[model samples]
Target: MVQVKVFDCEHEKDLEESMNKFLQKIDEKNILDIKYNVAAMVELDEDEQIYCFSAMILYRK
Candidate 1:
């Protein structure tokens, strides 16, 4: 069956580490595709910016 796993993190390194750990437990042949994305936005009243790192894994087991 096909399934999707989603992950989100504040930093790119954190996202990469999390994805790597998950991938290690699964078969590489079962992976269909991986989608990654990043977005940045400023706080409502702050000068600092917030970053969002996210990814989606599509696979069949």
Candidate 2:
């Protein structure tokens, strides 16, 4: 299992889209049967300029 963390997102939608894109990219790269799952998220400040994300990826060898 591999853990992925994305930081400094502008918006929630952006994060979601980025995560989806990452999933597709990983799948295309054939990274050991990767799986996408959102673990945690946080928005910083009122402008939402900063964001934190955590995801879990399970890969089968």
Q: Cα RMSD for candidate 1? A: 0.7
lDDT for each residue of candidate 2 in 1-61, tens digit (9 for 90 to 100): 4545343354567767776776665654445443333444445555443344444444322
Query: What TM-score do all the candidates reach, one by one?
Result: 0.95, 0.36
Task: Give me the overall lDDT of model 2.
Answer: 0.50
Displacement of the residue 44 alpha carbon in candidate 1, Å: 3.3
Name the runs in model 2 displaced over 4 angstroms: 1-5, 28-61
lDDT of 1 by residue, 25-54 (tens): 889999999999999999988789999999
Q: TM-score of the candidate numbered 1? A: 0.95
Query: What residue pairs are clashing in model 1?
Result: none
User: Residue 14 of model 2: what lDDT?
Assistant: 70
